[model samples]
Structure formats: structure tokens, C-alpha cells
Target chain A: AQSVSQHNHHVILSEAASLELGCNYSYGGTVNLFWYVQYPGQHLQLLLKYFSGDPLVKGIKGFEAEFIKSKFSFNLRKPSVQWSDTAEYFCAVTSGGSNDYKLSFGAGTTVTVRA
Target chain B: NAGVTQTPKFRVLKTGQSMTLLCAQDMNHEYMYWYRQDPGMGLRLIHYSVGEGTTAKGEVPDGYNVSRLKKQNFLLGLESAAPSQTSVYFCASSYSSSGGLAKNIQYFGAGTRLSVL
Candidate 1:
């Protein structure tokens, strides 16, 4: 089974501060990477995903992620953040073939942006 | 449009009690999955169904059973609840396309919080 590791457990930043969350997976083959965010009392929503294309993928709310195959990492980043961006972020990965139906998720990173 | 819906938003069970969690999807997806989320353990898959009448085990499937009688409905059952089973359960569904960029993008439910004492 593929495993995902998130570098940070919790992060705090002020408004307009740059934010970056580190995520790495343990798969070496073809893989699909994703970032999902869950706001307070809300279900998880897709931030972005990378299948097979440019390493850098942009998502909603000014969020973007870079998929570095060499490092086995797909890190999420945002130049500026707002109070609304304060939520729990999860990094997930799924490989090809019969195992595509399963997604292995990271432990998650909680971001708190103070306004 | 309710993409995926999980019944009984909150549930409490005794040590030996039995309960079922219901999941329904209106998007006509071919794949459905059940996962449990703990404090810092992230989400762990308990069971999944590729199509109607077909189910498979995931990373953590012990003490849990699942049934897919209809294409739109998936049921997860616990014959005897345990404290370790206490967590927020989420149901997700995704369209099964052979070769598409949006094939496995899962849509998740609001989740059901379960507590076993």
C-alpha cells in the first residue's frame, strides 16, 4: 500500500502571509496526487490534482501544488492567505491498475490564518 | 444536488451494540467507498464497492461488513461495536471512466460521527 507523509501537523500565519505545506508519497510508479481541504464543519473539497502532465498544478483559492517525481513529493503552496484559508489540508495519492480505487491520505496539516 | 449523502449524522452505540451506516449517491457513480477519520490518523478506507453486488476490503476492514444491493446505495454494518470503531465515517463516490482525467475524483459526504462506549 502507498503511504503519504505530511511534514507539518499545524501551522499558524497572519493574513497575507505566504503558506506552504509539504507532502510526500512512497510510490515510485505512475500515480495520481491530490490535495483536499476541509473547512470548519464542512466536507472535504478538492484543491487540485495531478495525473500526468506539468508538474505544477494550480487550484482554486489561489492554491497550487508542485509534483516532483524525483523527490516523490507533491507540496501545496499559496502566495497569500486569508482567514478563510484556515482549514485542514490533506494530501492523497492513488496509483494505477487495480489499486486505483483506493486513495492513501496523509496525516493532514491544520492551517490557522489570523486576520 | 446531493452528490453523496450519509444517514444518521451522529450515532452512539454500546460495546456490543450493532448498527448500520447508510450511504446514498445520486450521481450514478460506479464506485463507492467507506472511510473512517480519526483525530490525527487521517482517513482510512474500511470497504469499497466497484459496482453493484461487488465489494472489496481496504486498508482497515476488520469488524466491518458492507453490502451494495443497489447502484445508488451502500450499507456498512458493524455486528458488535467496539471503542476502536468510534470515528467520523465518510462515504465517497467516483465515476469510473476508462481513460479520462476526471475518472477517480471522489465526491465525499458530510460524514457520520460515531461513538462507541
Candidate 2:
């Protein structure tokens, strides 16, 4: 079974402030990691994913995440934030290496970007 | 192309009432999924289908049933609606490769907000 955990429940940041949201996962086998964002009145959108190759993955709207294998973490980061960035972020995982594509999602992190 | 579309944007049902939610995707993806989202709970998988005429249970399939009669359509049914079944349901699809690494970049619908009184 694959599970995901997001450390922060709610985050409040000012515009132009750096941002980092913690995410961790536990699965016996290898797993694929992803970060998804849900803006107000919108469906969940894919931020970025880490399947293979480079651990540092960049996403739309200036968002990025690093996949640390040793720590079993895939934390989302951004150099600067905007008020429009306010949204709920989710971390998800799926079994890797020919396993079925069943996604397990985290509780989510609510970001409130103050302008 | 309409990536994924869910019908009945909002619904309210009385206890013991039954209803069905419709989902359609035009991307010709191979994998389709149904999930429910609640406050603080994120998205929990209810059921999924790999292809037409095939359906499988997911993390939270006890209270819900799903069917994939056609390749582009997936239906989720609530036989006996309960208060616990009230949630925002989302449908998603992905193009899964036949071999290693199924490539799971899911495209999601706007979601259906269902409330059971």
C-alpha cells in the first residue's frame, strides 16, 4: 500500500515570500510522486511529477519540487508567491515498477497568500 | 477536446435515495478513476476502470458502485444515499502504458458536489 503525508495543514505567507510545503511518503516498493494544486472554484491541476531522471522538477506558475530518495520526501517549493497562488496543494503517490496506477493522496496543505 | 466531464454539477438527495453520477472523457485514455473529496481528507479513490466493461474497487468503494459500460463513459451509483456519502466527487482519466511505468498524469473533471440530507 502507498500513503502520503503533508506536514503543514495551513500556511500563510505574504506576497513575494519564499514558500516550501513538506510532503513525505511511505511505500515498501518504489513509487511515483506528484504535486497537485486546486485553486478556488477550479478542479485539481497537476503541478509537477517525479517519475524518473532529474530529482528536481519544475512546474507551472513558478512552482517546483525536489525528490529526495534517501529521506523519502518530495517537498514543494517556490521562490516567490503571489496572492493568486492561494490554493490547496496535494501530494500523491502511486506504486512504481509495473504496479497498477492507483494513486494515494495526502491530506493537503491550504496556502493563503496574502497580497 | 473535453478532457474529463462530470454531470450533475450539484445534487441533493434524501436519505435512502439512490442516484447515479455520469463521467465522460474524450481523451481516449485507458484508465478512469472515481474519487471523493472532503474537508481535510483530500481525495480518496472510490473505484476505477482500466478499460471498457471492467471495473475495480479502490480505497473507499464500500458505499459506492461503479460501472464502465462504454469506453468513454463511467458511471458511479449510490444505491442508498446516506449522510456520510455527501461529498464532492471527482472523475479522472489517464493514458496508461501497457508496459513499465504506466505514466499516470491524470486529467480531472470539475467535480460533482453531492449532499445527502
Candidate 3:
């Protein structure tokens, strides 16, 4: 079974600080990776996705993620985060196979950006 | 576009009560999904439909029933509600993949907060 793990449960950062959220998935074969963010009182929205491309994928906002196949990790990073970046982040994966198109998601990490 | 919308944004149910949660998508996408978000539990897939008449069980489907009788709507029913079923439910839609890894993003609804006591 495929599972996703996110190391951090709650993260606190001040405005202008750098941010990095770790995500790791247990899947040996090719997989699709995704990061979704949900602001307070909002729905989850796609942040970035990696199917087949350069290891680095950039999404909306200043966020980016690196898909490291060997380490089974796809960590999200932003050089500088603002108060508006406070949200719950989720990492998900889907095994690229016939029986597992459904995504498995991590427990999620809550990030609070202080101004 | 209305995107994905789940009705009854908030509801409270007594144990053993039955209710249906409706999910509707206007994107004309070919795939619809139901998920429940619990504290420390991420989103667990409940059910999904590939097309108007086709439905499949997802990771957690034992206590729920689903119907996708129309292309734009997917309904999730709780035959007998329980406090354990209290959670925020999300609906999502995506393009057709025929069981392949989908690169297309899943558009989500605002979510329905259901509390079963």
C-alpha cells in the first residue's frame, strides 16, 4: 500500500522567513505527486504537481517542490514566506498504475506565518 | 464556472439517522470523488465515479453508499450516522484517465462540515 508522510505537524514562521515542508511517499514505481494548500475557511487548492518533468516543479505563488526519486521525497520550499502564506499544506501521491489512480495524502502540516 | 460544489455546508445528525450529501460539478470533467477529512487523518477517499453511471470504492467505503446517476452529480449517503463519522467532507472532480495516473488537477468543493452525535 502507498502512504505519504509529512514530518512536521505544526510550523510557525515570521514574515520574510524561509520555509520548507518535508513530504515523503512510499511507492517504488512511477507516481504522480501533488501539493495542495487550504487557507483558513477555504477549500483545498492545488499548489503544484509533478508527473514527468524536471525534478523541480514550480507552481502558483513563490512555492516550488523537488521530486527526488531515490529518496522518495517531494519537499516544498519557498525562499521567503509572508503572513498570507499561512495555510494547511498537504502532500499526495498516486501510483502510476491501473489499480491505483486514487491519491494517498499525508496527514497535513499547518503553517502559521506571523507578521 | 461554479466548479465543484457540495450542498449542506454544515449539518448535525443524531446517531442512526440517515442523510445524503450531494456533490455537483459543473466543469464537465469525467471523474468525481468523495473524501472525508478528519483530524490527523488527512483526506480519505470514500468513493469515486469515472463517468455518469460508473462508481468505484476508494480507500474507506465500508460505511458509505454512493450514486452517480447523472454526469454532474455524485451523492454520498450515510445509512446510519455515528459520532465517528463526524468530519469535513470534500468533493472533487478531474478529467478522465481510465485508471491511469492523472496529471490533471482535482478541483475541490468548499466542503461540508458534518457532525454526527
Candidate 4:
């Protein structure tokens, strides 16, 4: 079975601080990666995805993630953080095989950006 | 367009009771899914539907039943609720793999918080 791992359980950062959340998966085959964010009292929204293209993918709200195939990691990053960026972030992955449509999500990382 | 909506934002059920969760989408998506979110556990898929009249089990489908009688509606039922079933349930919809766009991009609903005591 495939599983996703998020190393950061909770992170507290000041405004304008750089952000980096680590994510890794346990699958060796072809895979599709995604990052989703859930703001306070808001639905889960897609931040970015990686199928087969540039390793670095930019998403909404000045967020970006890099997919490092060799490391089996897809880490989410932001050059600078804002108070509004406080939310719970999830890293998910799916096999590129026939059942690639199903997603396997990791334990989310809660980010708190203090102003 | 209300992408995806789940009814009864919050519910309280006693053990051994029964209830059904309603999920509706106006996006005309061919695929619908049910998931449960627990503290520190992210989300676990309970069931999914490829199309109307077709349902399939997912990662955790032991105590849940699903029905997709209409293309725009998907229902998840708990025949006999248990305390262990208390969790936040979410419904999502997305385009199928056969569609031009990738099937991994899913639109989720505002989840339903259920408590069984």
C-alpha cells in the first residue's frame, strides 16, 4: 500500500518568514502529487499538482512546490509568509497506474503565521 | 455554481441509530467520492462512484454504504451508527479519467461534522 508522510506536524512562523514543509511518499512507480490547503472554517482547496512537467510548480497565493523524483519527495514552499497563509496543509499522492485517480493523503501540517 | 455541497453541516446521533448524508454537485462531474477526516489523520476515502448507479468501496468502507441514484446526487448512509464513526465527513466531485483533464483535481464540499455518543 502507498502512503504519504509529512514531517512537520505544526509550524509557527512570523510574517515574512520563509516557509518549507517536507513531504515524502512510499511508492517507487510513477506517481502524481498534489498539495491541498484548508483555511479556518473553509473547504479544502487545491494549491498545486505535479503530473509530468516542470519539477517546480506554482500555485495560488504565492505558494510553490518542488517534486524531487530521486528523493521521493514533494515539498511545499513559500519565499515569504503572510498572516493570511495560516492554515492546514496536506500532501497527497496517487499512483500513475490505472487507479491513479484515487488519492492517498498524509497527516496534515498546521501552519500558524503570526503577525 | 455550487461546486459540491453536503447536507446537515452538523449532526448528533446515538449509537445504533441510523442516518444518511446527502451530497450534491452541480458541476456535472462524473466521479463522486466520500471521505472522513479525523484529527491528525488527514482524510480517508470511504466510498466512490464512477457514475450514476455505480458504486465502489474505497480505503475505509466497513461501516458505510453509498448510493448514486442520480448523476448529481450521492448519498452515504450509516445503517447503525457507532461511537467510532464520529468524525467529519466530506464529499468531493471531479471529472473522470476519460475526460481530457487529469482526474486528480477534485472539488471538495464543506464537510459534515457528525458526533455519535
Better of 2 and 3 by DockQ: 2
Which pairs clash in model 3? none
lDDT of each: 0.93, 0.92, 0.92, 0.94
Predicted model 3 interface RMSD: 2.8
Q: Give the CA lDDT, 0 to 100, for residue A25 in model 1.
A: 96
The TM-scores, one per candidate, come to 0.97, 0.97, 0.96, 0.97
Q: How close to the true structure is residue A24 of candidate 1, measured as C-alpha lDDT?
A: 97
lDDT of 3 by residue, B9-90 (tens): 9999999999999999998888899999998889999999888999999989988999999999999999999998999999
**TM-score value, chain A, candidate 2:** 0.96
Which ranking of candidates, highest DockQ first?
2, 4, 3, 1
Error of 2 at A76 (Å): 0.1
Our tally of clashes for model 4 stands at 0
- Residue pairs with backbone overlap in model 2: none
lDDT of 1 by residue, A1-115 (tens): 7989999999999999999999999999989999999998888999999887899999999999999999999999999999999999999999955447688999999999999
Winner by DockQ between candidate 4 and candidate 3:
4
Better of 3 and 4 by lDDT: 4
Residue A99 error for model 4, in Å?
A: 4.4
- Clashes in model 4: which pairs? none
TM-score of 3: 0.96
TM-score of chain A of each: 0.97, 0.96, 0.96, 0.97
lDDT of 2 by residue, B1-117 (tens): 778999999999999999999999998987899999999888999999988999999989998999999999999999999999999999999886766565578889999999999
- CAPRI-wise, candidate 3 is medium
